[model samples]
Target: MDLSIRVIRSDEWEKARELRLAALRDPVAHLAFLDTYEAAVVRPDSFWQERTEGGSEDGPGTVRQFVAEAPDGRWLGTASVLVERAGAESFFADVPEGEQTHVVGVFVREEARGSGAIDALFEAAVEWSWSLAEPRVERVRLFVHAENARAQAVYRRLGFAPTGVRVALHGSEDAHEVEYEVLRPAA
Candidate 1:
């Protein structure tokens, strides 16, 4: 089935929220997301409001979210990119003038995984990142659980290469996360 990829609007926050909750319920959610379903469920409307605004077309440059929607308007999957700057405190590291987009929260419904939903969502994100004019995004990156071979394979197929950086998992003494990067397409 064909799916369209686009940026979500503020008024459609509920759909975004619902898809997020569904993603949290996936079997590998523990490996894919940093937050738990219980934590998300209790977050107030204001939290959702801020999240929606931050990722919409008119929000700040720090973050953006892309979704794959079916013809009937149901969401198939989603992905978000966060712009990280040098010398700025990052969610996982401190960086020094170049801008990079960090891809996160990638998910496609089980039935939609092999179709084109994931690719479409990623293309949208990459397009948006490259479209930035000023602090031209230099690259797109994502971190994957070291144990998530499936995700790693998919990312590799999409042209991301391991950056050889490893971050220790916050609470898991034996686990680590690996970084992957894809250079920005030439103009």
Candidate 2:
């Protein structure tokens, strides 16, 4: 199906909420995302409303969410990027040495897998990161579950290389999240 990839608008919070809930229920959600469906489903509308608005185009501007939308207005998948600067206090892992963008909340509907939606979303995300003027992004990075080989393969194909850093998966003792990065192109 034909789709358009673009940053989500602040007023489209409902669509963002629905898409996020659907993503949390995917079969690979256990390995692909940090939040569980049960935890997310219980969140109040206000929470979703704020979360959606924060990632929208009109939000604080350090974060952005990109979605793949079908011509019929259905959202197929989504990805979000969080810009982290050195010495900043991050909600997850420690901020790396440079100003970089962390790719997160990535999800592509099963039906849309391998349809190029993922690539399009990431392209929009990385392009947007590179276009930032305040702190030039030095790299783009993302974490993948140790067992998520499918995602690792996709990241490799997209030119991201493992940075030899492994973070313990939240709430999991035996699992790890591998870090991968793509540096800014030489000018």
Candidate 3:
């Protein structure tokens, strides 16, 4: 099965919404996403439109969403990255004093697991981060739920290493998200 990996376009908002809803319903959604399916489902269409537009290729480079689409046009998986600059207050984890990209909204269909789609999605996301011009990204990072060993293994296999940083989730110290990162490759 051939899968094309590419950044999403603004007009594809509905498709993006569909994929996100499906992802939120996945069995591991609780551990993989901070947002709940119930919450996401009730959001207005405008919310999805704006979200997709901001993460689209035609939008500002601050965010980009990549999708793996099969020949039949179904999205096999999706991933998004957000640029966090130095001295800025990030909504999630704190960053070092440098610009970096944060990966989020990662999801792959259960049937698509083990199909290299995840690797391809990450490759596109990381490449997009390194391609930014102004305040060039210094590294690519992501937060995985502390109990999510399945995701940890995949991230490690993809060359991401734990940054020895962890952040509380939903103001609960008992639940945390561990940070992992990969520095920009030397030119």
Instruction: Please provide, for model 2 over 40-144, each residue's C-alpha lDDT reduced to its tens digit, 9 standing for 90 to 100.
Output: 888888898888888898999999999999999999999999999988876557886789999999999999998999999989999999999978899999999
Total residue pair clashes for candidate 1: 3
lDDT of each: 0.86, 0.90, 0.92
Question: All candidates' TM-scores?
Answer: 0.95, 0.96, 0.97
Residue-level lDDT for 66 in candidate 2: 96
Model 1: lowest-lDDT 10 consecutive positions: 89-98
Best of the candidates, lDDT: 3
lDDT of 1 by residue, 58-77 (tens): 77867888989888998999
In order of TM-score, best first, we have: 3, 2, 1
Global fold similarity of model 3 (TM-score): 0.97
Top candidate when judged by TM-score against the true structure: 3
lDDT of 3: 0.92
Report how far residue 93 has shifted in candidate 1, in Å.
2.0
Candidate 2 TM-score, C-alpha based: 0.96
